[model samples]
Target: MSEHQPLSVDGQPQQLNQDEATQLAEELKQQIRNGVIPAGDSDSIERMVAGLGDPRGLMRLTFAESLGVVGKAAVPSLCRALSEHDSVTVRRAAAKTLTLIEDPRALPVLLKALLNDPDPVVQGSAVGAMAAVGAEAIDGLLEVLINPNSTAMQLGLASWGLAFVGARAPEALRNAATSDHAEIRCAAIAALGDQIQSLDDSEARGLVEQGLKDSDRDVRAEAATLLGKLHNPAWAAPLLEPMLNDPEGQVRKNAALSLMKLQATASRPALDVRLSQEDQTDVQAVLKLAINQLDQAG
Candidate 1:
């Protein structure tokens, strides 16, 4: 096909070969730069979606970005490609493009893909698109996190999406942190950590502190991990130094790592004490590292 070949033929969308796809993408980009948006008509949208299957990596990315510029007008076609398309490449590209579009109208389809898609890449991309949708995606992502039947991988992705959108939904995440379900609580603690990191949210910090005392070991561990990642040594060091006494070895190990990250030099005495008493070799090793790091920090 010629570089100037039309996107459609005889009222239907036509597939672009590599050269044709590259040329079309470049022309569309130039038009965008010149303040002209591409047409979002049915044929035009389908032609761009079709380009998502191009074997050339860069061509597919160009088409996805150009479709992103088409905005909500391209949502229906991209959703169809993500949920119904036979090609995994097309499905992945459709999800990625929708991430850039970030329209709430695509939420239901993206949620379905995240929950039911057989391909790991497709599922991951769908959740990433949900993350980009921001606050509007919180409820759907939490629903997945709360489902008992959700796989570990699904739970992890939902937690990740929840964290990505946490700053926008602090009240919602705060409510979720008090949930009756441990899974929900765990995810919420992680989300609240994200809120703390981005906003230095005092309320979120308080909640994470409460999480350190949760009945569930996973919840306590997550809380410890979260505080370790936050760089406020004065606040985090005092909170984390005591977690070395946590019953779960993972929690204790994570606490040591976080102390190391914060350069909590004052915790050297605590680390030395923990190292002498830690039964888990892994925790003992991390406590030693924390002590070594603190000595260097001094």
Candidate 2:
């Protein structure tokens, strides 16, 4: 078949025979491996891959992998496909390709797709791509997290992305911790705790303390859980101890669990007091467990 002639398989376009498609893919891979796409030649390669007529999506995946092999050189065309392509399959393939390339230039289009893509798979791919860009993607991810228009799922994905964006992310997290928007603040605090290993004790403590005092019960509960993950004895008294008295049962339970994780012997007295007055059976059980853990440690 002529390279330009569109072949049909099950009524879907199949531009090249299997052998021809494979040969073209291999050639692109070799060129990519060699770090040369002959300058301005990437557009041609992208066009060829985008034209592949595989109905089952296997050929599209194969070609997308080849685009990934092409690396930064393929970014411009891939970004185009991600933003301008009419086919969701092609757009999704482009997003995957950009993720493999991990070029920061793809950030704008990737962020756009993450927020607006009608396809969940495409939005997820954009999230993965943002993560693949690492530190460079932090600002854009933060923008998404802070946007009131962002969906709960988008905020969750952006928060997850921030956790993977390296040490620079904490600065954004710090800002988000105090956002007027409760969801942003909650997500930021949760992300801050997730990266506690990368933070200094003071930074972690300050952020978690802020969360524990938040008016929102969800933020307080998340903070209590984060403190447990940190396992810092320093937080047991000023932080976890007071949380045992929080009106929110979930917060009290999390605080007790955190105290247990820290093995805070000092919290034993407070745990005893909480257990005597705790109305929720679950919170009381956790308080008893905290007391038991402290006893064992002592």
- Per-residue lDDT tens digits for candidate 2, residues 86-120, read 67877787787788888777788888899999888
The stretch of ten residues in a row with the least summed lDDT in candidate 2 is 1-10
* Candidate maximizing TM-score: 1
Candidate 2, RMSD to the unseen true structure:
7.4
Please provide the root mean square deviation of candidate 1 (C-alpha atoms, Å). 6.7
lDDT of 1 by residue, 84-150 (tens): 7788999999999999998887888888899998988998999999999877788789889877788
Clashing pairs in 2: 13-53
lDDT of each: 0.85, 0.74
TM-score of each: 0.83, 0.76
Candidate 1 global lDDT: 0.85
- Model 2, runs deviating above 4 Å: 1-17, 33-42, 48-66, 69-73, 83-90, 103-105, 116-120, 134-152, 199-201, 236-238, 288-298
Residue 24 displacement in candidate 1 (angstroms): 5.1
